[model samples]
Target: MKKIVSFTIMAVLIMGAAVMNGDYVSAASVDGLNDKINELEKKKDKIDEKQGKLSDKQKNTEEKMAKNKDKQAKVNNEINSIDQKLTKTRNKIQAKESEITETNQEIESLTGQIKSMKKKIENLKKEIKVLKERIEQREKLLKDRLRAIQSNGGSMRYIEVILGSQSFGDFISRSTAVNTIMDQDEDIMQTHMAEKREVQNKKSEVVNKKKQIEQKKKEVEQKKASLQNQKQDLESLTSKLNNQMSEKEQLMGELKEEHQKMEKYKMSVAEKQQALSDQAAVIAEAKEKASSEKERLKQLAEKREREAKQQKENSSSTSGSGSAAPSSSGGASTASSGGSGIFIWPASGSVSSGYGGRDLGYHYGIDLAPGYGAPVHAAASGVVTRSAVSSSYGNVIYIYHPQYDKSTVYAHLSSRSVSLGQSVSTGQTIGAVGNTGNSYGAHLHFEVHEGPWNYHSGINPFPYLP
Candidate 1:
């Protein structure tokens, strides 16, 4: 792309130079130079415009680059934050682990207490059974004693036993025996009843204690289940958080790559910009030199015009064409009619550059700014060797002159009027002025390539022209 730009500008420069060096020119010839001069002005304007556009584009590019960098930085920050979260989560996991350990210990402690309660419940059940048996035995003995009292006739049985005494002394002994027996029987019955009540109370106590232990067991089991669920929930949440962190890390990686690519792109753009600047310098230098050459040619034209005007006055009696070189262009005197190794102007245009490399890049041709659709003639008769659009030169035309061991390359032409392998004569129009592919503007970019590397044919066309 840069090469194309270089060629286009060179073509414009050559076109500008073409108008600056016409000998035997006059006001009449100004029409021909007018197009080229206008073209040069247009080129100057275009350069300014393009510079502005380029500046804007560069600014945008830089802004995009800065924004990308900032985005990458933000991504980095997010990654860091995620890392911190991961760290905190890990700590929480450790803490959770400790909590789990304590919960396990509690479960174990609860289990042991439950085991002890179970043993107590079992022992109480056995003690209650034993107490009930002992109470039943005491009640059975009291019932038998009551039965024996009833046999003696309940309340009257005691009196009848005392009255049935065999003698007075015998009766007294019988009565005493009956009273003592009844009292003893009553005492035994009361004691037995009391013992039975105590046994029932003891059984109730044991049953209540067993129920309390069972309730405690149920509570601990519920607590253990809850802790297990909590641990599972915590693990699941940790996994989700980890996944989020991983996603953030992946995002950070992508941002980093984009940032790196932008930096590399920035470097490349900067290098290309530098090259463009250098090329501009070279073009400026060429313009300065061409300007100097134009001044010299102009001075020479003025001197020749004065002499031609003198001669015209001397031949006042004959028909006058004014000057052979058309003094109308800048009022220059006519150029010499006959000269050795003379070549006619290939196209009517101002030369924008000389036959050497110019700035922006190695511009290998002189530029000629001709009128739109102007005829471009062959410098000398030769075979049309190459005619095509090139990657950098756009529409290009190449001619090979016989016996010169050299070739001329014309680039940035609008169209070619000749065919490859066709022979052309000197002064024959073989092409037209145009701005084609890779060309920034209209003009003819012309170059003379010498036989070999040591020849100026590719670098300079001055020595080859008359």
Candidate 2:
């Protein structure tokens, strides 16, 4: 009986020690699982914080984009107004030219009329000279007749001749002959005077006509000069208007380019936000998985504790309780550490402008000039979200990093080497720098965003660039 009691005591001690060992193993497994759950929760918290920052950035960017669009619309209206004014100015110039041509033609016609009048005046002067000569001849003839009459003893000689007549018939003949000669001389003098007066009147009329023609010609010439001066003024004004139109067109082009850029940026931002939402879903799923695993671990720990307690109770009784070994059958999965938000330089160059307000309003990217056709590289490993020509950015590319919940943009490219949905690694060549879109010189415009690519989502790129 003593030997049997000793064996029983040894068996009881062994069984108790085995039960305690099982309890210790169960506690250790539960502690390890708890640590894994805490780590997963920490990761999820970090993701939440990042998501919150991105959401705020999205809101601000959207507001800024709306304001920019409004300003762009106003600029477009102004450009259209300038175009209308330019068209009207051009029409006025054309009308002025036509008026000048017509005025020149009238002046030419008046010049011909003045030449004809001058020729007519010369012919009239010739006719007046002939009339003057005829008048002088008639006057000399009258003088000669008077001289002859005097030589013949004038009126007394005529009376004596009539008194000395031998017969009455002879006396009558002498009286009749003297009267006829005097009458003839008087008639000749009157005819000469009349012809002279008529010629003088005709000459005077022609002279008046010439004077009128000359006055008309002078007026026409003056008109022509005025027209010429007007034409010159109009041409000058037209030239000025053309210059103004050219300047306005340039301004409008710049404004349009800027507007397009803003629009593209807004679109990119919106897309990035969608990507973020998708990433958030993934993170939520991961958190849910972690929660499920934690619950499983807790249940397993409780079950092991219950079994250990039951084993202890059975071991204290008179009967021996067979205890099964604790089995640990759980696994933990960890997420990969994503991008650090640091980037390689997309192009080899010096920074020309930084993110912030500028002459053109809020600028969301950095400008780098390295001459034309400089190779542009990816800042980080990502999937190409966009790769195509943009009216404002030229050949541009957008890269999205799901792991980091961030996006990058490269603008003003001469050529694009990547395509949408293409995967790219860090420092991979994606395009070439250029002076396209709203850019004034050959350069690269790059941007980074913590969330989606939005107008206000951009941070200073220098901090993230090498």
Candidate 3:
């Protein structure tokens, strides 16, 4: 009877020890889950901080882009104005050239006229010399006639000469000769006076014509000089305008380059923001799961403790309550299995192009034809690895599933609802599909990767989709 009583006590102690061991295991599990949840929460907070900085950067970049566009417009206007000025100046220069050409022709004609007038003056001088010689000869002849008349007692000589005739015919001839001598002397004086007057008129005409031609030439020369000055001014203006245009073009080029850089930077910030958002989402999901697990463990620990107490009490009375622990373990296994490796359709669309060779190059993703602004959802519960714009991709999103070692990409989105590092659930609306990047129309370019998300790391997404 003593041995039987000892065996009963030993069995009771063993049962008590097992109950305590089970309670310790449950409490430890709860503590571990709580610690994991705390770690995930911390990670989410860090991601949030990073996302805030990226958002600020994106805002600043957008502002810069706006200012750059404005500056570019202003530069373009200035360049256009400079071009107009250059055209006007060029036209003015051409007009001045025409005027100068006309003035030069006028100058040549005036020079020829001056030369002709000089030749005329020379001829007039020669004519005047011949007239003066004739006048001198005529004066000499008259003087001689006067001297002979005086030497022969003037009127008496004339009467003697007239009476010295041989017959009646001779007398008539002498009288005619005396009358012709007087008429000839009077004609010589009149001719000398007329020749002197003609010479004087010719000299006066030459002087006046020369003066007029010189004045005309002076005026024409002044006009040509004026035209030259105007042309020079126009040339200078054209040069200045060209310089201004060149400077404006250079500035515009620089501004364009800067604008491009800003766009790229803005895209990068957006991508970082998205990545952070996805990470935060993943952490939050993990925290939620850890919390749930902790609670479940706590409940299990309480249930086990109660059952242990009941078993101890029932052992004192009967023996059939040990099956409850294995049942609870099975329930925990079911819960754990419910939380992994599931995906859903990312968007509503028909596949327009499958992953393969394209016109330009190899297509890395499947193109989905959806109307603009169509809703895009997460393919699975995962962290957003990236969200941003690319020159080739436009707006895009990347979701990474750590559990499955898989990543999904959604490209050519018009707008995104979620940010970087955000956690997303399966079928959660993360963005809207639209024409973005190098796309021809509104569509979603979807990709799936078994490993890290990369351009070359993509596989055919059709096989993975439901």
TM-score for each of the candidates? 0.42, 0.52, 0.53
What are the lDDT figures for the candidates, one per model? 0.63, 0.69, 0.73
In terms of TM-score, the best-performing candidate is 3
TM-score of 3: 0.53
lDDT head-to-head 1 vs 2, winner = 2
Q: Which residue runs of candidate 3 sit more than 4 Å off their true CA positions?
A: 1-33, 61-102, 122-160, 237-261, 285-384, 387-466
lDDT per residue for candidate 1 within 191-288, as digits (tens), equals 76776676677678767866776777677677768767776877787787788778877777777777666665555445334433433433344354
| Rank order (by lDDT, best first) | 3, 2, 1
What C-alpha lDDT does candidate 2 achieve relative to the native structure?
Answer: 0.69
How far is 87's C-alpha from truth in model 1 (Å)? 6.1
- Per-residue error (Å), model 3, residue 140: 6.9
Number of backbone collisions per candidate: 33, 1, 21
Q: What does candidate 3's lDDT look like per residue over 1-466, in tens digits?
A: 0111111122223433544554433455555456656665665676677677778878888988999999999999888888888888888888889889988998998999898888888888898899889888877987897898888898888788889989889999999998897787778778878898888888888889988999899999888888888888888888888888889999999999999889877866765565555445555555655566566567767886887777777776655444444322111111121233355668777888898988877888788887899999998766676777766688888877654557898989999887655667788999998898878989999888764354347777766665
The CA lDDT at 439 in model 3 is 84
lDDT of 2 by residue, 1-466 (tens): 0111111122223433443554433454445545544654564566566657756766776776677667667766776776787687678768877876887787778777777777877787788788888888888987897898899988788778778888889888988887887688778978988998889798789878878878877887787788778778767776876777677677767766775665676665555555444434433544454456446546766876787778788787856756656464322222232434368788887888888998858888899888899899998777665676666776788776544546799998999998765668899999899988777889999988774344357777777664
In terms of TM-score, which candidate is stronger, 1 or 3? 3
Native-to-model Cα distance after best TM-score fit, residue 139 in candidate 1, in Å: 3.0
Q: Compute the lDDT of residue 277 as modeled in candidate 2.
A: 48
